[model samples]
Target: MYDTILVPTDGSTVAEHAVDHAIDLAETYDATVHALYVVDTSAVDIGLGTEQVDRIRQGKFGDMPELEQRARDATGAVATKAADCGLDVTEAVVGGQPHGQIADYADDHDVDLIVMGSAGRSGVRRALLGSVAERTLRTTRRPVLVVDAETGTGSD
Candidate 1:
């Protein structure tokens, strides 16, 4: 049913958990998996967040060295996992608000579904910061398969 599946990763253990779900879906539908790493610009106003956003806005993803490494590490992990499962995977790194960026990526790329972790590293901060997966679900029209890393389930 799906031709392209999007999996957003933050290099967290929770995010890695969702990678398994995405790979499974991709294999089922014979779809390609797109691994996206969004550096949340809203989280930090200082170094990488702000700087990377400006570069991304200008369509320059190669200017920031350290941030690029981080993005590579995050997306690369997902790509490697999907590859091991014999799935075709693509990787992308961008800077923006996580939820919005994720939805936009899905729309812009014509993604058929999004499989993401319910909670990431923003554990304690979740109450105050809110959940990225929740926000993406609220904003996107595409089918979202949220993998609950804490419980190892895909329901919620």
Candidate 2:
């Protein structure tokens, strides 16, 4: 029932599974898959001093380019995999919080569905550290299909 499926990846094993599942769904529905990779800005702020942050802002850490390239590569890989499955695919890499970026993409692109992997953290852990999937589900207007990471069978 989907026309355009948005699949956001983070290069994690769990996220890869989400990509595979999204590809399959796209293929089945004759939908176009839009693969996205978001660089989590929050991760870069963890445990960083002012000087470290300044250096990072100045591109001295040597990690920024690599991270951007990784995101691009991951998006490309997902698109390629979907194409190999005989599905139409497009890819993009965006910066900022994963949830925000993904939601914005869905809003801007007329995406009919979002397929993402949930890390499956619960109770205390989930409360302490929120989840991207949870946030996206709360904010996005499109239908979302969350693949549980614990199942480990998305590729099949």
TM-score of each: 0.86, 0.83
Alpha-carbon runs more than 4 Å astray in model 1: 47-52, 56-63, 120-127
**CA deviation > 4 Å runs, candidate 2:** 45-63, 152-156
- For candidate 1, give the lDDT of residue 66: 77
Tens-place lDDT per residue, model 1, 127-147, is: 687788989989999999889
Q: What is the C-alpha lDDT of each candidate?
A: 0.84, 0.81
Judged by whole-model lDDT over C-alpha atoms, candidate 1 comes out at: 0.84
Predicted candidate 2 versus true structure: per-residue lDDT over 1-156, tens digit per residue: 899999998778888879878888888899999998876656777886767555544325554678767777888888789888888888877656778889999999999989899898989999998889899988887888888898955321
CA shift of 111, model 2, Å = 0.3
Weakest 10 consecutive residues of candidate 2 by summed lDDT: 54-63
**Ten-residue stretch with the least lDDT total in model 1:** 56-65
RMSD of each: 2.8, 4.3
